[model samples]
Target: MEKQTSANKPHIMTIPYPYQGHMNPMLQFSKRLASKGVQITILATNDVKTSKLAHTSSINIEYISYEIEQGDEIPKSVAAGLGYVNHKVLKRVPGIIEKHKASGSPIKVIVYDSLIHGALELAHKLGLRGASLFTQTCAVCSVYYHVQRGSLALPLEGHTVSLPSIPVLEIEDLPSLVQAHDRLYPGLLEVIKKQFVDLEKAEWIFFNVFDKLEEEIAKWLSSQWPIKTIGPSIPSMFLDKRLPDDRDYGLNLFKPDAEACIKWLSAKATGSVVYVSFGSVANLAQNHMDELAWGLLNSNINFLWVVRETEQNKLPGNFKAEASEKGLVVSWCPQLEVLAHKAVGSFMTHCGWNSTLEALSLGMPMLVMPQWADQTTNAKYVVDVWQTGVWVKARDKEIFTREDITNRIKDVMDGAKGEELRVNAIKWKEQAVEAMSEGGSSDKNIDEFISKVISTTT
Candidate 1:
């Protein structure tokens, strides 16, 4: 084991593209890096500033807020796409960087989000060290690379393309998210390719995935470019193993909702209740929510759902009704504590990286309902590789159809395969913990990664 040291005590600026998933991982990465002597500054847009999140700790690292000057000339959609609000914000960063250098907080390196391609050009122009923090997994990165090289094209509109190299996935039963049609966003892919052209500008590339989880593909990635596998980056610094492990608190964020729903699980027996949550950001249409409402009603299983503001639709006003006495519905609750609870036998989730990791970490079986973005990719791993979940495709878009809604949830909760998935989910959970422990793959990569990126700051 390596002792903490001050070798990496050079100033590092982390600029994440504006988004929850991207921002969260970079913050956690910098937090851990700062703990080991790295001086990190998280750069956020002035409009979508990270001012409140700046660590006010006694650590030597500093966080600076710089605004991309806002202007009225650009349309709302165009500004988001261009990564600028007003021309001022784009024009000001270089000046800000120069000022920082003048102030003696000389940036030894700049860590930019891969999605922000323009930042690469700006970094080179300013003469600073730089790296690209890819918030997606190595597999997704490989798909982007292979697609760029012409080895693959997104499957034709109606067909599926087979990726034989991906382990645990068969050609005949290809995971829905990995399938050809309805894959990759047409507009976003174009933006990504242009940004990737700036790959040569980066000093290093870091991915949000682990060695044990994607070893083969990660190795393949390293062959083409300087790559680091350091992921499953949940703000896991929060977990306390010293506490009693009764389990089933469910999945959640920095705050724990342990008391909020653990009581609901108390009355239910193990392997009897199903939990459904699609994460904080994703929302299905009202009809879909209604369909899901009735689906839960028909499943003959006791279920708990956490519906957010966006998922609002007129379901039976007291949808949880007599079941309200039996079922629980809340706009939001602590997720991890619920997942860890004793009564949560299964989870129907949105397949986000954090959720997937929590499910795998807790050894809880899942029913994957990927909404969009990396969720599709996450679902593939859950249902295909981990053998811990079932993928529920949104085949019938009319989410109002009671029959489709009820049957999908039913398939996830009570199929003959659910029990097998439960056993495997637990085994993977242990493996996940081991991967983060001493000499674990995640621990090794975190050490190795700092050396490759922030360590050279001086």
Candidate 2:
């Protein structure tokens, strides 16, 4: 396809932090901008060069090739990737910017993942507009903001904590990074800290959230920063159907077993299946995995579980053979499609921000079992704030017994409380639709962002 760039179109480069969870939201946002007649080119790292973003997608995706050794730990590996970008990819961005200029689509704005704060410096040197796109919820970011300001002391003190615009949070409600700052990965903690450091320098700040979803917190956060909640950053087809063909996210890091999963779901009665996924990155321990497997078996409910290839080994021996009658296990299935399916009664997830938003968008009740990062905060909101799902708590030593899982599944699937959860899920789902529809809160923000970019460019 030919490049659609001109002086009037406001060409922008969207750069994510180069992980699947990070890249997916940026790509969805890029699609939204492209629909609004903005010229969008997504900048990705070498790892994403293999992502199956359709060739027919309206947005253009370009890769920055750089290599670094992967460390044993997630935080150290992420840090190394960021270091490579600082040393290698940053050097090449100027040439790419100049090339776009030569092609008559000069890059006017750099909308980057908040984690890669160096992009703001690069934008300043190039005299281009910079926008920070935050992928997490305002609530989670609020906690981090307080941490950055030292308003919320580290190695947390009490049983419960309170902050402005957020409900009182238990020790477990805070992000794991905050809960165990001294014990957990410091590199990731440092990276999260940098997101808020030079944030005031950016021309725009976009959060992948919707106003009504976090009105109080969004209001409070925006008063301090130029925060715009232009999200539920999901595909239009699931929300408003504004972009008719935007059925999937247009990019997938894991090849989904779409046909098999869909065929299985099609046979189940409506609202009969539990759709389980811990997202692309989270890994469950062997004991936890075994317990979860047996829990699902005991629940006696139809379920579809996405166990990444690497993590499948942790499943109990003969678990697959044993579960074949009531469950469908695949490495990955099209999550959005699965969630939207009539047979999927509820979602059992790690409460990753993207997965949480997707379930909300699709009106699926949740069974949140958060592992780390913002997930803990998200799970808190899921159970208490949103009233959409039941939480499956881990017992002593973080062991999620089969009993805990079975009981929670029953709570979400079989009673008056379950019906109430479904009602709340539908309410939030409608709000999400309104936010993405024409003239809605998130749509209005996108329009404002476009107008600002064009006005500055002209």
Top-scoring candidate (TM-score): 2
Off by over 4 Å in 2: 1-7, 46-54, 69-78, 394-397
Question: Tens digit of lDDT per residue, candidate 2, span 249-317?
Answer: 767778899999999999999999999999999999888899999999999999999999999889999
Alpha carbon lDDT of each predicted model: 0.64, 0.87
Looking at candidate 1, the ten consecutive residues that score lowest on lDDT are 242-251
Residue 328 lDDT (model 1): 81
Give the Cα RMSD of candidate 1. Answer: 4.9
Residue-wise lDDT of candidate 1 within 184-271, one digit each (tens)?
A: 3334455554546858657778886667777788887777778776565554533323112222221123233446677778888976
- Segments of candidate 1 deviating more than 4 angstroms: 1-8, 45-70, 76-82, 85-92, 154-158, 167-186, 237-259, 262-272, 393-416, 452-458
**lDDT for 402 (candidate 1):** 60
lDDT assessment of candidate 2: 0.87
